[model samples]
Target: MKKNIAKYIEQFEQTLNFSDLSWWIIDYKNDPGYFYCNKVMANTFNLDINAQKHSVVDTCPIAGDYIKNVHLASTNKANLIIKEYLELLNQEKKEYNNTFPYYDKNIDTVKYFSSKAKALELDEEGNVSILFGLIENITSKETLSKELKEYHNIIDTNVMTATTNTKGIILNCSSALCNITGYSKEELVGQKYNILKHPDTSEKVFEKMELALAKGEIWENEIKNQKKNGEEYWIKLIVSPIFNEQGKIKAFTTINQDITDKKIIEKLSKKDKLTNLYNRAKLDILLEKELQTFERYETNSSIIMLDIDYFKSINDNYGHLIGDKVLVQIASILRSNTRITDFVGRWGGEEFLIICPNSDIENTEKVASKLKDVLEFSDFGMKKNVTASFGISSYKENDTVDTLLQRADNALYNAKENGRNTVELIP
Candidate 1:
């Protein structure tokens, strides 16, 4: 019987040496303090690896203390699993498995491991005498899982997110989305996605979005949406198509950023502070778009540049406050007189521009003449009637924004050169 036990011990040592796992055995019958610890396990705890057995008090004090005190010391949430696992290993006769953290004194770092242990031997009284254990390092996997959980938490808090089926029915929405839209998750789920769409948003925009989605392509846009309170808001939305294993579209995920305040700031930035008219920068952009339209479709368009006649003298005669009021009134007049398709902006100090789309030189000249007549008769809150000189330029085959504006500027110069309150056209 002693010889058979000796041969089993030799075979176990050979088995431990041939494998890459960390393995250990504890003996509590004949030698309570002495235990078999393979090289991997010994080196993990900075123990004497060459020795076949370790003494608990002298050779591996840290290891012994850790194993003995783990249940008492591991009261924190991060180590609760380890404590329970140790209890089961010590008390139960069956195998138990767990993942826990261990402090390695050799490298002075905490390493995670998936470990299992069982009672390997029982004494005559059926009390546990020997225990066998195996552990595998899983620090990297735990670390990655922790990082991914953190990232998910961050996105859930900050992004207005939702998932929808292919039919545009809402499946789920994040809390942030509910907060921004003033809708509860229960109200949003199982509803069509268009419930939040503002009427002012053109159907063409939705058509384009649907077209892109049908192609399994991502679509991004700034959308005007209405909240539950009927208040309007804007969102910069990105919709991505989720795919299945066969690469077919399964669902769609939307990531949205609340951009209402940004849109307000941008609108304010594009307008004149006092007059609430588009400033020169915005006018330049509008003019470029008009130019592109003309170049693409050969559509007729025109630019009308006008300024208050003797505007400096009006400022000199009355206070600048009255002059500002006069400008405001004139802006209102221009807005009321122009067609809905025309774009009006305050070009600069005392100068304004109107971009007329799909209008020829003759039609634009008629528009300038009409505006000139309207200004000549309008009251500007002053004793005298306010008048303005108008300059008109129609789009040519190869006209640039600069060249177009320059021609209108020259036409305005000609109008001012000829007389103050007249209309002039440069074809």
Candidate 2:
């Protein structure tokens, strides 16, 4: 049988160009020392080839300890690879194929290789006598695999991820996704991903989303979804279509994050709790932007300052509850009567500020007058129609926040002196 194996080796050498590839053989008579390679590997590793036919552990200096001592310190990956290869031998498998990294001592470089091995000859009792293998370098592919692993690691840490079939059936989901959705892997797999969808999100939005995915484009948007407990949440969602080797859609991968807290904070920061109008902070921001627009482009923008007439009397007589209701009613009227380009805010208690973009002093006064009429006609629960005094000021050249506000306040004092139910303009 040994002679037959030698003849097969001779025939293989003659049939194929073996010079370019690294080849090896093993007798399996010993442990790690049983492995042996040809003169090519010997020269590559600066080892003696003649002694490889014998017990390499006894002959070559690095044979038995090569995997441990030579592989890079980070993973000791070569040792693991060799251990798995030996386990395959114990399985009575006739062929072996695996890829792993190794250290080449002669060049002092770490190289990735695919090793393919097969039984070449059998001894008596059906034990293996000779094993042959071919090793090919694959460093570039291994490097890319390593980089992709790192990229996946980063994404896994930061995002909840899931994969669904083209039919929108869930295939797999990360632990983060399961955690956020209050579902287990057992419960999620094989379920339709629409289980998380919000009813308020129209079917048309989903149609557009699916259309984009069909075209192999990534879809990104804010999505409202329901959790397992029937609680709704907002997510910054991204969906990407995964294609098979044939360039056909195989699946879609989704990554998303909870943005419910962010949306709530933004809404709270910009709105007043009592009147549902914009808050003082938001009013300041809008005013600054309007002033900036006027400075840059000479756009006519104006501010209207209005104070609820005798607000303290309303609180003292009708109570703060009625005063709050009056404020809410006023905010609703302001929102209903003003152009969409105008913004209304509760600048402070009993003081409302309005920002009107592209409005001159005349248009601003007209807006103020219209507001006065609306307030005068609107009834308070006190059985009397409530009224507000208005002061209008258009943007002037070289105006700061303080100067603009001062002019409006001075105009408001004039309105109060002139008996409170009128629009006073500062030109």
Candidate 3:
């Protein structure tokens, strides 16, 4: 039986020689030294690779130092390390697991190692006497993780950063994000990330983001978000997936830049300075979008084109200043009478365009008639009443922006020929 046991031990040592892991056996009952150690294990402690026995604690001071130094990232992790050490010392558990940083004499640098050990023999008195263990060098992996954490820390302090779980729950956030959003870190953490979602953002935008993230792809876009004070802000947001060792997405990190000022500038460029309404260029874009919506979704929409009656006479008689005031007043009336969803813009000269999305000709005629009545009754401080003629055109299957505007212009001419201050619809 002793011969068979020695043969088995020899086979185990040979097997461990082929592995990168450091393997060793300790005889606690007889010598308090390693009964056998493979080359990797002996080389790790700078001991004799050919030696059959060595004092475990005398030669491996690194292990003793590791147990004495308990600096860990968190209290919970420190406690677990202590528990693992106690389990190994008492030999109460079937298996022991631990990781520690130790100064390597051979390399003259601190390195990290992971260890797994189990009891291999029992003494006559039923106590554990022989222990087998393996140690693996994990310095590269641990160093990379530490470097990544440092990078994240720097970004979180200087930029708007936030991290979320797969379920969209906010896990962590930066002070910059809290400052920009007007929320406290305590209030934002553990909350769903959508608390800042603005009502004006379409659901389709969020759907697209979700689909891309689910495929572990980065998503980037300009998003309009609301603050705690109900003020709207814009952000150019980029979201990246964080992967685990298994190459599966574990979380998402978002980096954002405030773009509200940029958005404001773009909006100003699209507006008419005189009346504070969308300029003709913006009107063209709105018209095209409405037409595309109709073609794609089969949703009906209409445009109302109205021209001030004899507007050249007003500019000549009232001076261009009073004419400008009249134009501003007319723009205000259009804004007040139309739904928020309607796009009201200055078409050109004395003409204004109102694009009513999801509205048919009948509903659009009602809107035009309401505006005509309002203009006729409202006092523009001019000597005489100022009235406007209205023309309406619904979007057709093959309608383009040019075709739609041409039809509306024709309808406006018909209204002017019939008698001013009336509304007419051209199908």
Which candidate ranks first by TM-score, i.e. highest? 1
Best by lDDT: 3
Greater lDDT among 1 and 3 belongs to 3
Per-residue alpha-carbon lDDT of model 3 for 248-347, expressed as tens digits? 9999999989999999999888999888899998988888887788988999899999999999999999899999999999999999999999999998
User: What would the TM-scores of all predictions be?
Assistant: 0.67, 0.57, 0.53
Error of 2 at 98 (Å): 4.3
Model 3 residue 16 distance off true place after TM-score fit, in angstroms: 2.3
Model 2 lDDT per residue over 190-283, tens place:
9998888988877787889999999999998888898899888889899999999999999999988889999788879999999989999998
Error of 3 at 392 (Å): 16
Quick one: RMSD of model 1? 6.0
Give the clash count for each candidate. Answer: 0, 0, 0
Task: Candidate 3: list runs displaced more than 4 Å.
Answer: 1-11, 33-36, 50-52, 65-86, 140-198, 201-229, 233-262, 272-276, 279-330, 337-427
Candidate 1: tens digits of C-alpha lDDT, residues 1-427: 2222345467677776786677766766667677677777777666776777888665542345455445533546335554654564467437777766666656666667777777766767777677667877788998899899899888877789999999999999988899989999999999998899999999899899999988999999999999999999999989999999999999999999889999999989898887888899999999999999999999999999998888998889997998898899989989999999899999988999999999998999999999999999986767888888988998888899999999999999999998879889898
Q: Give the better candidate number (1 or 2) by TM-score.
A: 1
